[model samples]
Target: MRNAVLLPNGFVLTTDNSAGIGEKEADLVHVSDEVVAYFATRVALMEQWAAGAHPISIVLHNFSGNKNWDKYVEGIKKLFGEIAQPCPEITGSTESNMETLQSAIAVTLIGKQKTDSAEKYTWYVYGKPCVGQEVMTESDKIADLKKIWESIKSGLVESVWPVGSTGIAEECKRLGLRCELQGWDIVKSAGPATTVLLGIAKNRIEEAKLHFGKYFEEIN
Candidate 1:
């Protein structure tokens, strides 16, 4: 799979790339996957709700890549701007120098927000690194999730002991984190998902969004 992760921070600045964010990584390949997955998932989710007819607003954290990130920013802007009919209110990060993986993660996580809409459910998808993609393991995922929750939540974050593969969802419950299975089937069956957007796309982006569903809902 793509092995991308999207950890959303409810009310923080996108440019807050501070050391206190989370674990920092220097690997470029890993960083790129994470950043791309983050943006792609967000875009896909918004596009679904936009229904190809309404405008979706989003604040993008334009970080990651290397010093040459700008060369590719235009393509991203165009992809998000042109694909959806209404398009997203995409914006770049306020910070300039985001060279590390941690910085990118921190920037994006801090900027995430949740809104209550009686019309439709609002889901915040938190991406997780796939197995074998990163040197990290379920232990690492849990640790990272805990650190993030501690930094954000005022009360004690729920705790879910590792119970095997199926226990993945339970872990989220304990940590108070959201799970993104990358497919609508799992997402839809899992419960009411405002948006089934996830970053860990291995075979296909739309296929991943299916989340155990029989057929994948292709993203436009």
Candidate 2:
């Protein structure tokens, strides 16, 4: 499915990736392991949470190596660790027989939502994103993501559509929505998907503000 598959038990299933577009050269010598895991895993989990799913497990596809595995896991843990929740079971493999020139990882989340109100939804872009360098340098990034998750849990956010290397402009086109995004660069890469599109309702805007705080942005 292009989107999450709605299951009969009120759950949803989805997957996402955080590949370096095959640009990383020589054993990922230049890329940061922690940054890769953080963005990649967060992207997958966010997609699940967007569908109102409570992530139960994560299956990681690690192409880095044994030496980098701990760092990757550490990054993933940091993502879930923000909410003070135990991370879901994680199991994955590292390439030992061969060496990849670049870093790549695919994160799959298995989750279930207890209930979905099935309300009519409105779309908006969320996050303060920029291209390049700061993907790792930013300190407040994870806390900001936590705020978005908190808003989702607060019933203010119905779902989220992650904006990957494709940037906001392409995602808006894909969703058949006009890119009314203001005060931002909509076509730049949100490296490691530092941003996402939120699905919400008009009535819950206030609640979103209360929970998301500085992380919330509107693009309709």
Candidate 3:
């Protein structure tokens, strides 16, 4: 039996399939900003899970750096100080290897049995007309956002609400969709039979409000 913790950005960390990098100094590595955040968040979440957690294998990924990948794993261990070392692995993809890869990833993260009932949830939000310094235009931003959304959604991740770009919302506003204009925040899952996810940030409350107001309306 094994257990896994998934990050908001749709990455799963586990101990299975730690074979992709050939040989390395450490068992884990960082691949991107999202991944770094995953490691940071995992440290906090694991402490909370310890109260009733069972023995589980773990998998950590994103060690694609050309140098010092092993050092990063040590850093993660030092940072989390709670999670046991996991088997490490690198990710690859081919049309033929898709299912096999996913299976490998799942087994590495959640183990052989728990994945049979993986829980899924969505975290949604909206943002303004502005673009980051590196992100040139709204069109470019839309394409990039869609790519990220597509990858996560392809993995059965759901979007709690329609993602509204400042451009998209402006178009929607013209169409009279009553788009709300406020900052955003997050709402976390509460207990059994619940499946809500939250953002990891200081202003998550305001971030959630940008779309759903104080509470979500019940669908009948």
The per-residue C-alpha lDDT of model 3 at residue 94 equals 22
Best by TM-score: 2
Q: What lDDT would candidate 2 get against the real structure?
A: 0.71
Per-prediction TM-score, please? 0.30, 0.80, 0.24
Per-candidate clashes come to: 16, 1, 15
State the number of backbone clashes in model 2: 1
Q: Cα lDDT of all candidates, in order?
A: 0.31, 0.71, 0.29
Candidate 2's displacement at residue 99, Å, is 3.6
Query: Which runs of model 2 end up more than 4 angstroms from their true locations?
Result: 1-13, 19-31, 138-143
lDDT of 3 by residue, 92-187 (tens): 222232222111111123322122213433233333233222222332222122222332323332222222122433333433444443442212
RMSD of each: 14.0, 3.3, 14.7
Candidate 2 positional error at 49, Å: 2.2
Best-to-worst lDDT order:
2, 1, 3
Query: Alpha-carbon error at 89 in model 1, in Å?
Result: 2.6
Compose the digit string of candidate 2's lDDT tens values, residues 19-71: 55333565423556776777677777766766767788787887755677788
Index of the highest-lDDT prediction: 2
Positional deviation of 158 in candidate 3, in angstroms? 19
